[model samples]
Target: MVLSVHEKVKSERLYKAFDLMAAKDLDAAETELHAGLSDAEAQEDKVLAALFYSSLGVLYKIKKEFPKAWKFYEKAEKLLPEDPALKLISARLLIDVFGQFDTAIRRCQKVLEISRSDPPFLHQANVTMGLALLKKGERTKAVSCLVDAMQDDFEGLLSASNIDLKLVEALLRKRSGLEECRAYLEKALRFAESKQEERHVELFRRLIEAFPTEEATDVKIQM
Candidate 1:
């Protein structure tokens, strides 16, 4: 249908913009997004407009234009007030880049309240909340949130190499639970094996190797 075609075009445009952004062709990326935004406005398609706005936010964030990014993100949020995805992304930026831990936690709580039915959303929300709590010196509650995040999408988390890599490092550094971290990496290795992802397999292998093994003194012989 016409709508599907429009969506496809919009999606392709968005991807192309992001690809350019990744390549550091900032001007071209901005041009692409702006053109798409104009088209969305011409169509009176607020959803697509919001999509471009959010993308602009990401682009500006990459350019280290925090205020511009925040403006675009807020514009998108206003257009789609109940959007948990926007909250998730904005929360991440607020906490990691802006160091607005309290605001990020508030946004994460909103995501938890609204995105319970979506496991990925809930999982990310929990992880973000955990990170925010950790920043606020609440380790116990942070660990609890991280545990909930792990439970929410263990398989999905394991499958994502970069995400899982950073998360595993964080867990190890924070000592969220060393046993759990090792076990998680073990499962990630298995997932890599199943998918025949050689890079992931090797990465997980090295990570698991980096973990300290059981000490000989901890073992006792039975008479």
Candidate 2:
């Protein structure tokens, strides 16, 4: 679809804002987001408005401003009802920031039901659901969801290795799945190596060290 002049400009600003956020320039990012929102509203583009609102929500979430994030997420949802990606992000915010485990689980499940072909979103949904379940003290179900998430490649998302490491750490805390955790750590280590993520590689190495001596020796041999 060919975007109108206004849409093209709005899109550019949104991308700029994302870049600024990644650079840790929150003030500049917020400025660009508000500017994009203005352009979107002037163009009467609900989709663009929803995108800016969602971006704002993400920005505030990263800043640890839960109330502001929630407000923007609500605005985005109101603009674009049943948007799977936005819903997944909102669910994550609810779980991580707001401590709304049950609501996050339901929202994530809804996204999972609708987004069968989208592996990245599916991975996010399952990971969010797992975190929520863990928060709710449903460790068994949480492990199931985390395992399901790890089964997917989750290509194009940089956090895949971190998510895998998180699952391994969660399993380690449970202390009953050392073998399975080792497998996941191995996968995460490979992913980290592929991405040249030295920190994550070291993190996986440390986690592996926590395994039983024999198992750790075996894993080292396998590596």
Candidate 3:
């Protein structure tokens, strides 16, 4: 399982690029990514090249350079057409950057179809699909997808995110059971508390306040 020198160099560059990107040093990040891409190309490793391209796509997307992001994603997809993770990224970009909900939902569905054994990817695909459906005015289906995502999230990671809040809001708007909506909001509240997300904490607090005493009491907050 030892990596060749080229793979080692490529991996190091990619990791550095990711760190730089996290620090908001976009120019340095882009340079490191390009260096990785060059090494990957020199090695004739399509998988490595695809990975670098996908990273570049995300970097450009974060910078709001949609065209460049799309171009890099397209290149990545061409190299790894069956990659579920890349497909999920492309779907997210389509929904968030390109406003292509239908296309994004289709891409997510495709990923879900192929990524049955990968629960983390499945959760992400479902969340992306739910978001796309929500944007498409299909609240009922959106709620279904979001619920599926939350149910699949055995680690509770996804349930602690704003996606849970989105689910609660959707259910409330649909006049779902008071206890059901409270349950989601409570999960969100715990997540906010854990992350020290004050805004989300306040939001959940306000939503919980709207519920009756019995329903609020029924919603248990996890420590």
Clashing pairs in 2: none
* Collision count for each candidate, in order: 0, 0, 0
Candidate 2 residue lDDT tens string, 43-149: 99877788789778888988999999899978987997876765765565566545778878988888888877766667767877887887788878877886677
State candidate 1's TM-score.
0.56
TM-scores of the candidates in the order shown: 0.56, 0.54, 0.49
How many residue pairs of model 3 clash at the backbone? 0
Task: Sort every candidate by lDDT, greatest first.
Answer: 2, 3, 1
**TM-score order of candidates, top first:** 1, 2, 3
lDDT, residue 73, model 2: 79
Clashes of 1: 0
Task: Report the C-alpha lDDT of model 1 over 1-223, residue by residue, as the tens digit.
Answer: 0111122233567768867876889889999999989888898877778778977887898789999999998888899788776576666656664566887899889988987666666767877887778778777777677667667335544344423233345555665556665676676677778767898788778767667543311211111
Cα RMSD (Å) per model? Answer: 9.6, 9.4, 9.9
- Which candidate's TM-score is highest? 1
The C-alpha lDDT values of all candidates are: 0.68, 0.70, 0.69
Residue pairs whose backbone atoms clash in candidate 1: none
